[model samples]
Target chain A: MKAVEVKHLYFRYSREWILEDVSLELEDKEFLAIIGPNGGGKTTFLRILLGFLKPTKGEVKIYNKPPNKASYLIGYVPQYTTFSTDIPIVVEDIVLQGRLRKGKFFYTKEDKKIAYEKMEILGILHLKDKKIKNLSGGERQKVLIARALSVEPKILIMDEPTSAIDIKGQNEILNLIESLELTRIVVSHDVKILFRKVDKIAYINKRAIIHEAPQLNIPKDRHFCEVELIDFLKGEECGI
Target chain B: MWDLINTSIYAGILLSIAIGIIGSLIVVNKATSITGSIAHGSFGGIGIGLYLGVSVIVSTLFFTILLAIVLGVVSLYFQDRKDSLIGVIWALGMSVGIIFLNLTSGYQADALSYLFGNILLVGDSDLKFMAITDLVLIFSIVFLYNRFLAMSYDIEFLRLRGINVSLLYFYFLILTSITIVMSVRAIGIILILALFTIPPLIAEKFTKKFYQTIILSSIIAFIFIASGILISYYYDLSPTPIIVLIASFGLFLSMLKRS
Candidate 1:
């Protein structure tokens, strides 16, 4: 079964359509990157996929189930900017929140063991007891990733995972994302991800155009910038 | 003097439980404005209760919860108009209360007590009610701890995790409204925000975890209230202002230390 299937999805906030008739599919374990200009409906598309916002029209199914039903199978890493660093929560608690499901009140010892395992994977086990306010931006991003990973999700979804980090931190996050083996969907504006062996690219701007990995004409072993990528995406031969 | 001290201590302990738990959430969730609005708006309930010759607690509980529900609905559904609407509700509730007090016959000494607080007037029945409120607050927090913690920063994450964010939020507001009403006699509406927010703010500085913050805030709030009561007894002053002043001083010192 496909990891995700979006059939003619449409969404709107007020009157004008934020997303219109967008459709795409991802095979199991497929890696997809969604890129678009600000307010170009990239986030909206992700929101609909995550079931935060229902599509105004059309259907979205994750592994043949609705987004809400398949929520347990999906791990989400929100944009770094969306969180307030001033919260007095420890890293362990934040990661443990990933284990939350219906009818479960307290975290069991087994849950703690899994949380530690995910933190260990993210190399943030040493930072478990530290407060979120005390962590660097990159460290905080890693915590969020660890929290998402703790869910043991079939699909890992991230929104602008490295947007707030420095260049070195961004590279670390990219490498980490590269190492993760899951059906991953990342919403990002960073062009470096294009070269990171992503399986496909979904360019969304009021409408969505899917480009399979083979269709991307990126030159290997040469540095590429965002403006150039946008130009390439807009080029008619690339099939916008 | 000993009986007054004992009563004030009991009130302080009960108030601290709420201050520590709900106050921590209030500060972390950035709900202080909404909490303040609910608190001040509860005056309308008190006034209506006095005017109708009903139990003030019952009237305030009904009024504040109704006001909080409306506030919660607006906050959840209307994103753009939240702040302006909160201001409107705050002023409207206070206005209604003042009008009701004006329309009532004779002197309205009860209005002063509700507005500014008179902890000395707390009776055995008041303590019983406060104990019940504390139980409700504790039970709700214990059961909803994980979700409420997540809701502090990321309601979307909780919603994605299959938690009903709106319903949880409504429940939180209702609990908050009840806690605020219960606290009115001990701290009054005007000063309640201080007791609800300042200790949590101070405790956040010294703690690394949310539960730690709540625990420390409860202890700190008790200290402030106890100290305020003792000082007020010696100086023959109102305990509410004394308590708030001490808490504020602690906050200032905390900020100074941090800076």
Candidate 2:
């Protein structure tokens, strides 16, 4: 079964179109990296997939169901930098938030067990008691990833997961993401993802171009500029 | 004198509970500006109540809840313009209150009481009402604690989790609106934001967990309120300003220590 299917999607905010007639598909357990420039509607497209915004025009489906209906199957990791640093919450609290289902007020023992298991999996069990603000950017991102994983989702979606981390941290996060067996969709501006084992790349700029990853032939030892990357994506046979 | 002192202390304790829970939320959510707008905007309802010769609480409750809903919508849909809109509502509310008071033919002495509360003047019925309000607020927070915390931490994540983020947001705003009304008699509109913000602001310095912040904030708020009441009683001065002044001093000290 396909993990995600977005067909002729269109989105806009007020006057200008943010996404235009974009479409893409992902098979189960596939890793897809979405790359785009600033104001390129990368984040806007993710919001639609999460069912936060209705597409102006088109259909978005996850596992053969609508985004809203398939919400339970998807775990979302939002940008760590987007939240306020002074929220006075520890890492444990944030991870527990993933277990938040409708009608459940308090965290059950089972929820705590699952949260702890995810924390351990991310090697952040010791840091669970640490405050979110006190953690390094890399650690904060890991905590967010753990939070997303605590849902035990079949699909994991991350937005700019490594944008705020150092290069070493970025590599570590990328490795961690690669290790996860779930179907993954990562939206990022970081060129470092090109070095990873992503199955496909979607370049979004008011529209989308989906390219198979192996065909790009990104050299491992050399640095890749964002502008050059966009040119490379455009040079490919990927369709818009 | 003894009765006045006792009643004021009781009011202070209740005030601490309300501000401790709601204030932590306000500070964490960065809704201080919106809350400030709502606090000031509630004055419009107070003025309308005065003009209509009806219960100020009822009129203020109706008006502020409506204002909260509007502000909530504006915050969601009009993110870029929310700051300016909040300012407009704040000024507009104060202006409408002043206009209504001016049009009213009475002495308007009670207007000062609403703007700057008299803790000593709190009667027995008012105490009962405050207790009831505190119970409701506590109940709501207890039942929806995780959702509220998630809302403050990352509203988008909560929405993706299938929670009705708007309804949760509106419910939060309504709680804030009611909290402001409950404090009007003890802290008043002009000085309420201080009590609503300062304790949590200070408590955040000492705690890393959300619930700890609330508990410590309640403790800190109680100390400020109790000391302010005591000092005001002895010095023959207004209690609310004294409370604000003491809380401000605490904030200053906390900042200094951090620096």
Candidate 3:
């Protein structure tokens, strides 16, 4: 089933048409990488998909429902995450926030247990009691991911989750997202490292061009005029 | 001399202690000028209080909440226009308050006290107000504490968790407004933000966590208030500015130490 559907979407900011008549049909549990040059509406389109902004025109449907009410099925992590470094809060409290929307049932022991379980999955369970400010940059991102997972979302949308982190941390987070068996839309600038983790690549430059079908062009260097995208793990479709 | 201290003194001491604790929170939240704006912007509410012969505390709360909602809406509407928009609202609210004071027939005494503050004039009723404000401040801080950190730290993540970022932002603004209104009588409208902000900033220099910063800042603020009051009582100086000056001096000292 299609997890996301966008039709005839249009958005403009300050005389620039960030997104124009863009449409997308995303499969469930698919790893989708959105790649584009700077100022290419990558962020704009991601935010639109996340329903943070109202479209200038047309429709965006997540799981065939309105995006505002469909938040339960989706999770979002933005690029800029550093804030109030001196707030003196532990990692567990930070992760618990992801479950805040479950009405009254969000605070159940099961929910808490599952949130803690995610900390173990993200390899930050040891840092659970540590204050967020005390954690390193990579560790903080791990906590953020653990927090995002506490919602039990089927769709994860990350806007440049690894932009500021080191390469190793980036690869680790990408692997973690891929292993979740959840649909993900990852927005990033680096294209080389993504060849294995992301099955489908959406090259967005004022618009989107998919490099999925059988094969994709791989450029030797990013500075080259032409970019590359190749099918990853298509031959070994792990039954995840 | 020691026998002069009892429930009122203890309550006064508690009052200062609570102010120091909550005051530190107020400052660390970076809502200082915003707190002052709420204090001064609430003059309109004070006018309403004096004109209708209601309690200034209640009136100030009403005005503070009203301005808070207005400030939240304005902040959202003019999200890009930072201080200028808030300044306009702040200026307008105080000027209208002055006009209202002028229109009132014989409420000048109440007007001056409310406009400037009369901490020395605090009696049983004032202490009672302080006690309640402190309770509310502490309770709200404890309850909304997690939300504050989440919104402050990773707003987008919180939003994805289905937390309405706008609602949290407005809720914080209302919290700040109430704190401002609460401090108005003790610290005066003009200097209330100093009590709310300065000590907390100085506290932030020494503390690492949100709670510690608030606690320490409030302690420092209370010390300033008490010492200033003590000095004014002994040496015949104005208490309000002295309190503010001490807090400011603490801030300078904190900065100098950091430097």
Docking class of 1: high
TM-score of chain A in every predicted structure:
0.96, 0.94, 0.85
Number of the top-ranking candidate, with lDDT as the measure: 2
**How high is the lDDT of residue A81 in model 1?**
81
Candidate 3: segments with Cα more than 4 A from true spot: A13-16, A81-86, A102-112, A129-131, A217-240, B1-29, B51-54, B105-110, B205-209, B212-214, B253-259
lDDT, residue A49, candidate 1: 83
**lDDT for model 2, on a 0 to 1 scale?**
0.90
| Per-residue C-alpha lDDT of model 3 across residues A1-240, encoded as one tens digit per residue | 689888878899668788887777788987888877789788888888877788888899989887877888877776645466665567888778777762342366887898899999999989887877678878887887787788788898887788778889888987787788898888888764455556666767665666552255444445643232322322223212
True contacts kept of 2: 0.81
In model 2, pairs of residues that clash are none
Each model's fraction of native contacts? 0.77, 0.81, 0.50
Scored by DockQ, the top model is 2
Model 3 scores a C-alpha lDDT of 0.71
Residue A117: error of model 3 in Å?
2.9
Sort by lDDT, top down from the best: 2, 1, 3
Predicted candidate 3 versus true structure: per-residue lDDT over B86-180, tens digit per residue: 78778877987888788778738757666556456566666676677678767767776666666666666667667677887787787667666
Error of 1 at B22 (Å): 1.5
DockQ for each of the predicted structures, in order?
Answer: 0.80, 0.81, 0.39
